[model samples]
Each structure stands twice: as structure tokens, then as C-alpha cells.
Target: MTDRTATAPDIVTGAGTDDACCLFQRALGERFKDLPRSVRDLHTVKGESGWQGRARVTRGKSRIGALICRLVGFPEEAEDIPVSVTIERRGDMELWRRDFGGKMFASVLCLRNGEERGHITERFGAMAFDIDLQLADDRLQFPVARGRILGVSLPRALLPVSEAGEFEMDGRFHFDVQVSLPGIGMLVRYQGHLNPVRSDD
Candidate 1:
């Protein structure tokens, strides 16, 4: 997404004092404990040296989607590494494209090493759409066969990481998500944790 209005926080933040990674793990456990009914189960598998897992998403109490995520292609001592995620959904096949791949509605942030690396943002006209994003300082512009873009800003907060390695932060992060469906004039907000993954462990 073109971050024309995106503003960096006045002060960037890290994790809690004990151990940033530990804090992250605790927070994720607490958050997932209350996942919506649409989500059946979420778990992380620790391999000999990395992480991988499958998240199951449900629809009307039936398992209908699965997302496989992994921290592959990272060095052993790499405190900050990249992750890859692939989501697959079943039902109303056409909607899946617009929901996950089309321009009008899609995730705006793709991260590498816990930093915003790229995204898919689009502007749509009824059915046709245009898209753009910034990856490693390079901007890739293109269009899609369907769906439209809704421009919005993402709200963020700072977590203070002290020299002693202890940290804590309090605030809600929000994102302005705009999308145009065939019959829906869309404007909405997506609210979630600023950083979902916590530790390299």
C-alpha cells in the first residue's frame, strides 16, 4: 500500500522487561485463548531449530480453511528473521480470490524480520482494480482482474525495551481497511496486536 499518510511513531518500542521474546510468547498464548469460534485451533511446532505450524479456520463451526506458516530460510542465531505464510480457504470459491488475492480486500502488510516489508493495496472500480506496494524500498505497481482498493492508515504504539532487557507497552493498534464489493460500499477497521510473534525460541 502507498503509505502516503502512514506516519512512523514518535518513539519506537520493543518488548517487556523480562525477555521480549518471552513476553511475546505469553501475549500470544493469552490472545489465542480467546480466539473467535471461526478459528478452531492454532499451534506452533518447534522443530530441531525453528518454528512451523498450521492454523485452522472454520466457517459455521466447520473447518474450511488452513494456513501454513513457517520460519524457514533463517540462520540459527538470527534473532530477527523472516516468515512465510500461505492461506487457503474453501467455499464460495469466487470470494476467496477477492478476499485473499484480489485488490479491493487484502492484507496491507507483509513482513520480513518482524518489519513491514511489502503489501498489496488496491483501488477498484466495480470489478477491475489496481494495486501497489513497497518491498525493500522498491515499489511494485500493478492491477488485478477484480476487486477495488480502500485506502486507510494503520495506528501503532511503542513498547519500551530497556538496556536491562525489560519492556512493556499498553495500547491498541488499529488499521483503516477499505474495500469495495459488488454491492457493498466498504469502510471498516481491523484491530489487532502490533506484533504477534514474540520470541526466536
Candidate 2:
């Protein structure tokens, strides 16, 4: 699906800019171009950006899973859930703050260091996850390569399973993310569409 032209000068459309490519572009390398413009436009932004959307959220039923979800600020089950996101550049990292029906949660994203170079690291409090990305057809996937808490690595069996990605449909940006744990059946799964909300909005 083709993306609408951005009237704002700060909006990023594609490559060949005097400034370096954004985080996703740098990590995906040559495969970045394969993504649909709907996905590319959101990831290519260089500065602070805002997005507004709606989602369907499903929270885990397990007692322990519910507790964990609450602790992590995961939103309650709902359809057509109001969603808003803000992405801001902080040094070499990008801070993503999301509000799902006013249940706010945020994380820090940055390229991993050392042997895990090229991969992305998403940190939530003291827990950090190393994500290995894959591109399939017109979709971008994120799989946990490694997970650590308080600087200690977690066993693979203990790590949460994630089925997450961003895709394009009918010229709009869409996303699906389902996270589950070893004992917990499901933590929270949310799928939705996002459209850029310019500063003037």
C-alpha cells in the first residue's frame, strides 16, 4: 500500500537524507527498503514524533499473569482501545512512550553492544531484552534473542515468548504483539493501526 505524501518538512519519507537513517533503518540495513512505505514512514522519523490509533487488547487470565501485567502497566481487556504513542530521540537511544486507554507504559530502545551488535535492546525497568529482527514479505518481526534482568541472563525456558510485528494494510500502518510466559498462558496481546499525528495536531 502506498503512503500519503507528508506535508511537514520534519516528516521522513525515505532514504538518501543528509542525516543518518533512523534506528530501524540502520538495524535492517539493505532489507529496510523492502518494507512498505506505511511501515517505513513511522520508523524513518529523525526527531520527536506522535501517533494516534486504536487497538484490541487481550490480557492474560492466569492469576500470576494478571499480577505481572498490572505491575508492568499493561492495559485491561478492551475493544477499540484508544492508543497514543510518542517516540523521542534521547542521545543514541529512542524512548517510546505508549498510552493504551490511559494505562501508560514506556521502554527504551537502542542497538545492542558487543557480540550482539546490529540487534536491538528494549529495556523495561531492570529487565532488558535483546531482539533479533526478521523481515518477511512486507512485515517486520521481533523475536527475543536473549533476556536479562539485573544484569543476569535468563534461561531460554524462562524467557517470555513474543509473537510481534508491524505490517501494512490498505495503505495504513498496523501492528500485532502477543507476549506470553513459561507458566503464564498469555500476558497481553494487542493489535492496532497507527497514523502519524503531526505536532500541529
Best by TM-score: 2
User: For residues 127-172, what per-residue lDDT tens digits would candidate 1 score against the true structure?
Assistant: 1222222112111122222232242322212111111111112422
Candidate 1 displacement at residue 44 in angstroms: 20
Task: Give RMSD to native, each candidate.
Answer: 19.2, 7.7
Off by over 4 Å in 1: 1-130, 134-174
The worst-scoring run of ten residues by lDDT in candidate 1 lies at 65-74
Q: lDDT: which candidate is best?
A: 2
Total clashes in model 1, counting residue pairs 3 or more apart in sequence or in different chains: 9
lDDT of 2 by residue, 1-201 (tens): 001111123122333332576777777788888888988888876888888899999988899998888777778899888898888765456778788888788777767872233589887776789999888877889989899988999998899898999999999999999999987788999999999997677
Model 1 TM-score, 2 decimals: 0.20
- State the number of backbone clashes in model 2: 0
Give every collision pair in model 1.
13-159, 14-159, 16-167, 17-166, 17-167, 104-148, 122-149, 124-148, 124-149
> Native-vs-model 1 lDDT?
0.21
TM per prediction:
0.20, 0.87
Task: Give residue 21's error in model 2 in angstroms.
Answer: 1.9
Superpose all Cα atoms of candidate 1 onto the true structure and report the RMSD in Å to 1 decimal.
19.2
